[model samples]
Target: MVGIGYRKDFAEEFSENTLNPAFIEVAPENWINVGGYYKKMFDKILEKYPLFVHGLSLSVGSPEGIDVAFVKQVKQFLDETKAVEYSEHLSFSKCENAHLFDLLPIPFTEDAVKNVSKNIRQVQDILERKIAIEIVSYYTPIAPEISEIDFINSIVSEADCNLLLDVNNVYVNGFNHQYNPKEFIPKLDLSKVKYIHMAGHTKVASDLIIDTHGENIIDPVYDLFQFTMELMQRDVPILLERDFNIPELEVLQHEMDRLQIIKTNALKQHKHAIIS
Candidate 1:
């Protein structure tokens, strides 16, 4: 099913079309203990639609170690909201005690994989639910001791966690890092894919692309999305992420319609393959 990120900029707009989305993804950090008007608003909406927690501060790859207290708070929030899944970046956002407020690339190494896997296991034990890790977009690799695909595969396999595949990131990283995005798609462990994120990026240069969700979904990204849908043997929740410059709800509804068409077509193709 197609979904969208819940942002306050278009809250009232979303209220009008409650049935348009299959689900809504929210950043737990934004509403963990929110009270008053916003809390009431969210609670009312929660009664209507399912929420998937896409976390911003888990800092899973932090060498400084995972935050136990924060994880407990997240667990409480998830239990309270009945969110179906909790997903965070495979990258780190903190070092030492300082909160960097940005997802940073983790080193592509065996030691880093071990550290991240341990962190995921701890989080899963605390939350009593399987966690999904988003494959992030980075302009540069921190430590290129291993290929990007292998690093990601090892982490999810060792952690025994699900994947939140971000298609735009694949396109951006492929352009900036000089790799075939299509080739990278099949290398992923499709069995672990639970969620998909599709967004637009900015082309600052002929060779550089930034994963900025401010713009509309571009043609190439749409092509990538179609390719992804055609490959998946199972249905996974796909979400449109627009963090800034959000247009009218109607504009988003159009995109949702497009996604529905793609999903329908993909399912037919998958079925034909099975029959053949």
Candidate 2:
């Protein structure tokens, strides 16, 4: 299954198109803060396609206690949409009553893992649905006390929540942190992965990978996606994220077509392997 993240302007076109993505990821802030006008538009889109909520402002990894009001509103929105799943980044977006507007990394230590797990569990308890956390891309390196994969695995295991594996983030972190992305994938508990996220990143200095989500899906990430599909051996739902430099509908459609081609070829290869 494959889907795309949508903003308000493209809601009608996406709804009208018969593409029928596996699911659409909605930003809670956009859907709620916009006047009732946008909500009406969202309702119409919901009528046409399945919706999933992916929040950017939750700041779940923040040390501050959860934002009760925001969580309540998000829950209401999720209930109204009957979203297939809800997800937020594993990094913090807020600190000291200010929005950093970036996904900041945390040290990979037992304390951080415990704190994150507690937050995740609280979110699940409030929503009455299991939630998934996405591993984010980090520009700066943190000399974590533990490895990134182990930290993520511990948090998910403790929180009893699913994982939303972001392939682009993995690639970016691998290049920036000098680790092998392929090695990290198999280390993660596959049972906890409910969905996968793929997106484009910017190339910096011809070596660094910046997760800008503004370019086309590159080859290395595509290759990793193929490997993941084969290893998972299941039709996991995939979401293509485009957050900057909004392209024309036709352009996005082409990307979707490319994704479909990759998915088909990868599945065929996996099948052949099984037969052999």
Candidate 3:
């Protein structure tokens, strides 16, 4: 399936122009405290396209614990949307008094893994739905004890949940960390991947890549998408994230068209290779 990750305000615009069904990524805070605003917005989108809940502040990797208040808000949204899947980033964004407002990496020690796993279990239980974690893009200051893939695998295995598998994040991390994306993608547990995220990023310096989902999906990311599609060996739902640089609806459609073409070509190549 194909979907677009969008904010709530654009529901009407999305309904009018989108030919294929799209997914809505509702931030709970935006809808929860606005006196039924979220409900009204959600109803409008559900009328047009499929909706899915993607949270930004769940802080699943935090040491404190799953935020029950946040979990309730997400559950309410899921109930309203009837979304098949709920997703959040694996990185932590909050602590007692600090809000990073960005995906922060966790130290990949056994203790950190255990704490995160426990928190994830609590979140799943509270939401009463299966949750998938996204692999976030980081700009170093990372703990040197563990590799990125190992850290992700450990959390998934311990939490016993699925992975969102952001392809752009993989490319970003690969470039920043000085590793090959090809070598990294195959190492993860493919079975745990539930949803795939694709977006555009910006190149700052010669070595720095930022996960800015504000532009068209570039060629290198498209190549990685092809590699991921081959690795998965199935037709999985890919969602394009465009949080910033909000362009004309036509531009978004163009990206979707490119993705469809890539998907088709990948399948054809796989079929031909098997036959040969």
Candidate 4:
């Protein structure tokens, strides 16, 4: 299945007969406490489709630690909306009292791993749900002490949490950090992956691929998504993100159609493998 993030710009474009998405995702922060037109719009969508919350401000890896109050509020929002899943980035977006406003790579150290795992456990307790952590696209590691795959696996295993695999991040990191994206995949605990995300990035330089999510889904990112589906050997719902410079609703529908085709073909391959 394929879905797109909820955006107010195209709010009017969504309805039962028009550009129907398998699901709709929104940042809970965007709808936690808004009123009037936006609230009604969201309500309408909720009536028709499955809702998923892709969180933005949890800052799970922040040294400042998890915010108990915010987690409670998010839980309340989830309860109200009856969202199926909630996901936040594994990287930290804050330090001390200052909001960095960008996802920063957590240091690759055993101490960092322990801290992040503890935070995830606390969040799970508060939310009363298993929250998936997204793999973020980052330019550099805080330290060269551990491989990215090891850092991720250690935290998820320790916390006993699910993963929100982002194919675009894998492609961007592979290019920026000089590694085969597929090689990184086998090291990961695929059993933990709950869903997948794919988006577009900007190739500013030959070696620097920045995850912008503002452009069209590039060929490489789609290739990576297809590769991931083959590895999983089953159907998993995928969400397309366009947080910046979002195009028309029709364009997103077109992308969704393409994704559906990929998933259809992948499932057929999987069935053949099982039968043979």
In order of appearance, the predictions have TM-scores of: 0.97, 0.92, 0.92, 0.97
Q: What's the CA RMSD for each of the models? A: 1.2, 1.9, 2.0, 1.2
lDDT of 3 by residue, 116-190 (tens): 888888898998877989998988745557767778899899999889989999999999989999999999999
Q: Tens digits of per-residue lDDT for model 4 on 181-244? A: 9899877999899988988889898789889998999887788888888888767779988888
**lDDT at residue 231 of model 4 (Cα atoms):** 86
Q: Which residue pairs in candidate 4 collide?
A: none
For all candidates in order, the CA lDDT equals 0.90, 0.83, 0.81, 0.88
Give the runs in model 3 whose Cα sits over 4 Å from its true position: 8-12, 35-42, 272-276
Off by over 4 Å in 4: 15-17
Pick the winner on lDDT between candidates 3 and 4.
4
**What range of 10 consecutive residues in model 2 has the weakest lDDT sum?**
14-23
Clashes of each: 0, 0, 0, 0
Ordering by TM-score = 1, 4, 2, 3
Better of 1 and 2 by lDDT: 1
Weakest lDDT window of 10 consecutive positions for candidate 1: 10-19
In candidate 3, list every pair of residues with a backbone clash: none
Whole-model alpha-carbon lDDT for candidate 3: 0.81
What tens-digit string does per-residue lDDT give for candidate 2 at 1-276? 678897766766766784557668877877765657667777777776688788888887878757778898999988878888899899888877678878889778889888888888888899898888998998874557888888999998999998999988998889987889999898999888988899999988766778998998888998898888878877778898888877777777777777777878888888999899
